[model samples]
Target: MSKGRGKMKKDTNIRIGTRGSALALWQANYISKSLSKLGVKSEIIIIKTLGDKLTRGVLSQNRNRGKSFFVKEIEDALLNYEIDIAVHSLKDVPPDMPDGLILAAVAKREDPSDAYISRKGNFLDHEKRKSIIGTSSPRRIAQLKHFYPEFSFMTLRGNVETRIRKMHELKLDGIVLAYAGVKRLGRKEEITKKIPISVILPAAGQGAIAVECRKKDRKVISILKELNDRRTSIAVEVERRVLTKLEGGCQVPVGVLARWRQDTLLVSAVIASLDGKEYLKEKSVMNQNNWKKKCDDLAELLLNRGGRAILKSIRK
Candidate 1:
């Protein structure tokens, strides 16, 4: 029995853990294909997380429950040696990782913008008054309020397909979702409009898939490194550092978007109150070689300029 267990641990096969949602499976299969190209094999194990189980309440209401609501269970599986790696939607991951876990690689990013899916024509049409939009993200709600103060929003829960279904079933005027998820599921045709990042910055690490493993799993890390996109990883890291410095959680009404252009990395971020009555926006640019310093400076700039107070108000 001991020898059999040892063999299993030493096997070349890698087991990947992920949420069972359609978008998650798509990400897992993508990793699998990427590994296959390198002569490695992998199997995906679907795991249900606390976030997945809580299908009724708005995520903001459960913010106090703690961060890592979506990735906790999968990380547990990895710690117990049940899965060699875990795949997560980078935006859902908290900035601080568990003691034994590390984000090993980040896949290439897709469009990081949010999509507006509306049944009643363009959502931004000034003629559309008193429109009801569906979203569960405080970030989206606060930012949208800043742009279209007249629109009312309701808490939208469920997977992408379920949310779209509910949009029709509930007779909602429109819904907001990540462009990456819709594009991954091949539902791009349903997008009524792509909300520009200029008007609404994306969540930190949005549109990127992260692969995590135990810190001691050097072999798996080495195998996964080939899939990491350097530019995407750097961009996401800058955004995540801002969130970490701000001590923001996944549900906080904070939005950050970062990109690399020419020889510079530019980051735009916002921290807003739930009511959108108070907010702060900061844009920082620096040479790519000094990305870390730029991220720190940007975070500090926001914090000093009412961003700290906005965060405090949100917590209260």
Candidate 2:
């Protein structure tokens, strides 16, 4: 067969499943555009998940039920063959892959720093005792307590716009959100400050878009290879592996970020008590070639340095 004919034969229309949020649509449209450049046709299908439906109050009541909260319904659609692809905010995906699903690609990441948005300028530095900051992420809450325990935190939840609106309606002093989401949604101007990674490490795969497909779908996997970013894939993989070893998730107060610098991989990880009283942090730098083993070693180091006890107490 001619190469042109072969290419035509392989050009199957892909069905992409994603959440209905603005950020999720941005990611889905991004993949769709990237595929269009490669001469592939695709459709974006919105699927709502439990994460979207549950309020913060319900979530607090069911702390143990959110690792795959955002991606579960989308994955179900993919597994049932209703969709050929599933795009997700990599941070929302659990470290453990479902039996039949595989992470086919990791798109190039956006800025991984969390953004601090306040109507009042530069709130993190100012001496504002008892200010009500808005966030529900255990990781963010723990770090904020550890660093700026003077401020009070309220559980804030919704899509980006909703959260931002709530910050006004609830009279919140400020809110911390992923800068990637804010930039993607064209709300960069709303960010009063970009939180430094040194102050609060991002969750594993925080800024990257993850593509998932059935394990046996070789054609979808091949198509997705064009979307994969190597450095990002390695960095998220290393971070996720560390989180998996630690058995950390949305319910746990753990933060991890991995980056590639030339041929080296640098990972900074932290595990803290829910109240932020006790904490364990480790920064590991290792050769990128042996990243798997190095990531395991890094997790072990954190666990040995009081991480295990912190996790045990939190679970209990």
Candidate 3:
């Protein structure tokens, strides 16, 4: 048994499983440092996931791939007791977890906005007809279409640096990416524009880091609990519940943003078709005391308001 955080001491080091990507390593290191504050020691174990292996083409090109593409292998390692815990970008985690695994904690969130990066002048100054944006997210595609119907789009895939490098090499107009990723990679200056959440709701759990451990591993969970941010966890929970209720995955053209305002929780979500032809959005607020019910209500509201039809069309 290893020592937990704080005064609790264990004899062994906590093994953290993470994807080998730079961003993933950063997140894992962040967790390790956080644990160190409580006097716990940890080691990062790099693991390759399907998402890491399929770097040849855009993820959107594969309709058969599931939401767990980036996380299944890591979860498997946790279940097999090969690692003590798994660190993941919450956006990559599916709403449902494998039977024995649980989301132990959600770290404090980063900037949740999406950013526009372009080698050309400012993206907004470019001519719409000539401007070609790059992104693989259907959510971004749909929302951007709603705002700038004249713009054309192409699939852009790769890590934060790779996308930026490809953008310059290909001399493409611009690419959309999560601002959190850019900031994590110390490339904040590359942002040409920060798309507001009002215009483009972020993906569920977009800016949060999640820690996963086996449900039976009480010691690991206890150590992780010290690093959990309560507000971030609640916000992401509401967002993910809406996603789960909608039966949407990370690849779905669904966007959700949730926040705490005063004593209330506000949730906004959107569901759209691949072509951006049909879109449904809903926003609701409720006292934090009824967060779970509010999440359900918000999902029901969206579903009743054409979201169901749009989701069905997307699945087909």
lDDT of each: 0.86, 0.87, 0.85
Q: How would the candidate models be sorted by TM-score, starting from the highest? A: 1, 2, 3
lDDT of 1 by residue, 1-316 (tens): 2211322254568898999999999999999999999999888899999988775664676664445889999988887788889999999889888898898999999989999999766756642778888998889999988878888988888889999999898888899999999999999999998998877889999999999988887888898899999889988988999888887876788899888887678889999888777778999987667878788888999999999988887788
In order of appearance, the predictions have TM-scores of 0.95, 0.95, 0.93
lDDT value for candidate 1? Answer: 0.86
Which residue pairs in model 1 clash with each other? none
Model 3 residue 174 lDDT score: 91
Error of 3 at 193 (Å): 1.8
Model 2 lDDT tens row, 1-316? 2212212135468888999999999999999999999888998999999988886587666556676788889988877787889999999999887898999999999988888998577569883887889998889988888888788889898889999999999889999999999999999989998899888889888989999998878888998999999989988988899999999887788899987788888899999876777878898897667878888888999999899998887777
Worst 10 residues of 3 by lDDT: 1-10
Error of 3 at 109 (Å): 0.5
What are the candidates' C-alpha RMSDs?
Answer: 2.2, 4.1, 3.4
Candidate 1 regions with alpha-carbon error over 4 angstroms? 1-10, 64-67
lDDT of 3 by residue, 207-262 (tens): 89999998878888988999999999988988899888888776788899888887
